[model samples]
Target: MASPAIHIPHGPARSAHLLQRTTAEWRERGEDLLLFAYGSLIWRPEFEYAEALPARVLGYHRALRMRSSVNRGSTHQPGLVLALLPGGSCRGLVYRVPRAIGEEALPQLWAREMPNGVYDPRWLHCDTPSGRLRALAFTLSRRSPNWTGPLHEPELLHIFRHAEGRYGTTLDYLLRTVQGLREHGIRDMELERQAHLAARHGLCAPP
Candidate 1:
C-alpha cells in the first residue's frame, strides 16, 4: 500500500536550525546518527559511516524533479536532481555514523545539501531489514524557488543536452543514479524510463 501525502512547513532558518538540533540531540543521546539516502548519497556518501543498510521511508518518493544549477547543471540551463517528495515510499540506503564522526559530517553535509537552504532536513522513520529506525533525511519543499514541480519534454531534453555544472552533466547524474540503484538491488522504474528516454534521444549513452 502507498503512504499518505505530507505537508512539511519550513522557515528561513529551518535548515540550519534543524541540522544543528538533530546533531545535538544525537550527541546528547550518545547513539549513532542515521541518515536516509535515496540519491547521490547512496553511491557517493563522501563521509565515514559505521554501517549502511537497505532502508525504506514512507510518505515520500524519489523524483528527479528538483532543479539544480550547481552540482549537476548550470545557470544558463538547469539540470534535474533527485528530491524526496510527498506520497508513496522510497527504497534506498540508511547510513549509520558514529557519534564522533557525525559531528564532523553534519557540517559538511549541511554545506553540500543546504547550499541555498532549499531542502528541509527531516527526521523520518525508515524501515530496514534490521529494523525500523528514525533517520535524518533531506526532503523537498515544493514552495522553494529551486523546486521544478514539472517540466515539459522539450525543456527536459534541453537540460539533458546542455546542463553541466561543477560536479558533472545532468545526463551523467541520471545514468549514475540508475546504476547506483541497480548496484544496490533497488530498482526505480521511473528513473530507468527517464534514462532510456535520454539515451534514445542521444542526450546520453545507453543506461
Candidate 2:
C-alpha cells in the first residue's frame, strides 16, 4: 500500500536548538564521534573527517521516503529524498570526526542536515570491517509530516524529472548518490532500479 501525501512544515529554529543541546552534551564528554552516511552525506559530507570506512547496519534500510523542499525541490513540486526507514538493512560508510574539531564541526553538520528537523537524529550500531561501532545517523519517522510514504516508480520518475532545488536538480542528486555508492562497491538495488527508470525516460546523467 502506498503511503499518503504529507505536508511538511518549516522549523529550522526549533531543530537547531535541539541539535545545539545534543551536540553540546557530546562535546562535554569528549567522546569520539562517528557519523553514518547513507544518502547525500556519502557524496556531500561537507565536513572534515579523520577517516571513513564501509559499514552495514541491521534492521533498517534506506528508502525514498522524505520530501525535499529546499535541497532538491520546492513546496509546490516536492521531490523525494532517501531516509532510513524501518526493516531490512543498509550498507554505507562510517565517518570519524576528530574530537579536537568535534565542537566546531557538529554545529555546521546540524545546520546542513537539520534544516527543518524532518529527521530524527539517532545513534545506531553498525558493523564495520574493523569491528562493531556506534555512529550517529539521521533516521526518518513515519509519523513525521515530512514522510512521503510509499511511492510508485512513475511517481518517482515524475518527481526526479522536474524537481529542482537550491542544491541542484533531483535527477542529479539521484545520479550522484548512485555513483557514490558504486565508488565504494555498495549497490542499493532500489536506487539503481530508479536510476534505470530515469534513464529510460531520456534523462541525461550529470557529467
Candidate 3:
C-alpha cells in the first residue's frame, strides 16, 4: 500500500490567515475555549467546528498514548481504553470556542467522543501561528500497561488498523493524522518511518 497523498485545504500561508480570523472572532465574541487535536479529530470531517486553526505545542511529543479495548472492525462501538507512554512532542490542530457558548458546547463535544473512560481530557499549552494558548486535548488512559512499557510501531499500527468508531476505522485515523501533520508543516521522522513501514508491509486499508 502506497502512502496517501496528504491534502492541505490551503497552503501554509492560509494557516496564518485562518489564525487571524479565529483570533478576531474569539476576541469579538469573548470566547474562553481552546481545543487541541492530536489524532483523528485533526482531520475527521464529522467532528467539525465553527473555527479551526493550525497550532502546535512545544516540549511534548505525539505517540500512541492511548489504547482501546473495544475493537471496531469497521464501525463505531462503545467501551474503554488505556493511555500509555509519555515523552516527545506532538503537532496537531486547535480550536477556540466563544466564552458564552464554551461551557454548553464542550459537554456536547465530550458526549460525542468521550462517552466512557476511553479518553482523558487535559489542558495543555499549545503554540499557534498567532501565539501560545492553552487548549483542551485528550490523551490515552494512564491505567493501561502500554502506558508504562515500551511500544512497537508495528504493533500499535496493527491495533489501530482494526479499531473502529463512529467516524471510521483506525487506519483512517492514521491516514488523517499523517495528513494533518503535513498540513500543519510539522514533521516527525519517527512517524514518517512508521508510515513507510506500514506502507511497505501493506498495513493500510485497501484503496
Q: Best by TM-score, which number?
A: 2
Q: Pick by lDDT: which candidate is best?
A: 1
Candidate 3: C-alpha RMSD to true structure equals 12.3
What does candidate 3's lDDT look like per residue over 113-202, in tens digits?
454334444566777777887776655434533252455765656655566755555555556667667776767565566566667667
Looking at model 2, how many pairs of residues clash?
0
Q: TM-score rank, highest first?
A: 2, 1, 3
In model 3, the runs with Cα more than 4 Å from the true position are 1-30, 45-50, 70-85, 141-148, 157-161, 205-207
Off by over 4 Å in 2: 1-10, 205-207
Model 1 lDDT at residue 203: 70
lDDT of each: 0.83, 0.82, 0.54
Candidate 2 clashing pairs? none
Model 2 global lDDT (CA atoms, 0 to 1): 0.82
lDDT of 1 by residue, 1-207 (tens): 222223434443655666666667667767888999999998889999988999999899999899887778877887878999988999999999987898899889887776656676777899998899888888876777778987777787888888998889988888889999999999999999888988889876788
